[model samples]
Target: MAEAQKPDLGPDPSLLILDDDESFLRRLAKAMEKRGFAVDIAGSVADGKARVTTNPPAYAVIDLRLEDGNGLDVVEQLREARPDARIVVLTGYGAIATAVAAVKAGATDYLSKPADAGDVTNALLAMTEDMPPPPENPMSADRVRWEHIQRVYELCDRNVSETARRLNMHRRTLQRILAKRSPR
Candidate 1:
């Protein structure tokens, strides 16, 4: 009998990750390198765009909020320049609206921050395949409100004071929103 052949599972061609958090970027790059990806890191949206333009990577992981600009611009550029590139958005802000926008803007996947290396790996894997299901709909007003709250809430790491401050509302109002979202 003939011997069976095994499929090859080699390192990916290349990957780029963009984020303002230097420590996180460095750690992520190292982890991905161990996983056999030739990784590049960019600290700002402009740098990310420039790198992509100069030499596009097979995969890109972007943060939705950047110090220089919103990460969506990078997403748009990637869509135009390298349509086959797999893109994933990692955000501290993950509201339904932004998630919807990310999908429409051509991101392959979206994940909340505090995401682990595995999350990043799975996201990359997901992007290489066809898109998965859209987020559920007929969203209740409360659900929508909750999603908004989560987006901003996570953006500020559930700090009522900071989230309220950023949202331009009284702390009490932000508290009330959270209270309403929480089940009795």
Candidate 2:
């Protein structure tokens, strides 16, 4: 049986969800489909940019970091292509600076990764002047710090010394953080 049409949030029901994580993208697409979006999925910045220019959706969910480039590039292009489109930036390593940047680049909202379809829907359909509610499970400060460290480490090709040098921290301290499990 087909699910009923979701409540009208806009004239267009077309939604685009872009992410490099294949499994998460697929799962979110499925859930959003159930919620009545005509979903399109893209796995890279280039593909997303192309899609935006050719056929921009009314709503978009883009990841912050991708293999090719920052997702903010896509957000800017989509905003240019469809000025009224609702775009949400999703990132696993969320930060205050990046959140502000996403907004500045024309994103309608920003969400941390592992967000459920319900949360995405609420954001996509929110009133124009409404202030978004806080995330259901915002990352702890320790978790955010750990994720940032891991990101820098990976960017430095997983070289502890280089990562430490770039972060301006001792090598041993970086090692200890890397060895420990991620904080909740």
Candidate 3:
């Protein structure tokens, strides 16, 4: 005799995605939904905070920089509101200082920008005690330097002269490097 079909389990718990980049947020939300999470997307800190206050998700992916404010604020609120929620902070301007701050602020994990859906998912689901192995092929020295320079450039509010002065490099040189695409 044929066995009876099992009942379908509903989608997993809610997952909040906060990012200022419209395209990236939309894509990631769809991907997370496909992976069984019920996703809520927020493009700013205010929106994220309101959502969390209304109904905090079980998991969250928050961008370090938001249009209205820093993502750390959201992280702190989420921690206060939902201590059990797993929070992963994503940043294009990755730095040791900020990473420490994020973790201290209650982030379960921190990932640099360009993190794909799979990476975000893994980070969110990883057990607190289980640390994943480092990447086999880390970024090359040149790529690292480029990323650093770009990060500083952004922090300087995209002012080429200011970024150059902050980095102690010539403006022309900084411009040249910025003109080139990031090295593989």
- What's the lDDT for candidate 3? 0.88
The TM-score values for the models, in the order shown, are: 0.69, 0.84, 0.84
Best by lDDT: 2
State, as a TM-score between 0 and 1, how close model 3 is to the true structure.
0.84
Cα distance off (Å), candidate 3, residue 33: 0.9
Q: Considering TM-score, which of the candidate structures 1 and 3 is the better prediction for this target?
A: 3
Error of 3 at 23 (Å): 0.8
Candidate 2 per-residue lDDT over residues 65-139, each given as its tens digit: 999999999999999999999999999876688999999999999888768888898888887799767767777
Q: Write the per-residue lDDT of candidate 1 for residues 26-104, one digit (tens) a residue.
A: 9998887776678899999999999989988878889999999999898899888888887889886556788899978
- Clash tally, candidates in order: 0, 0, 0
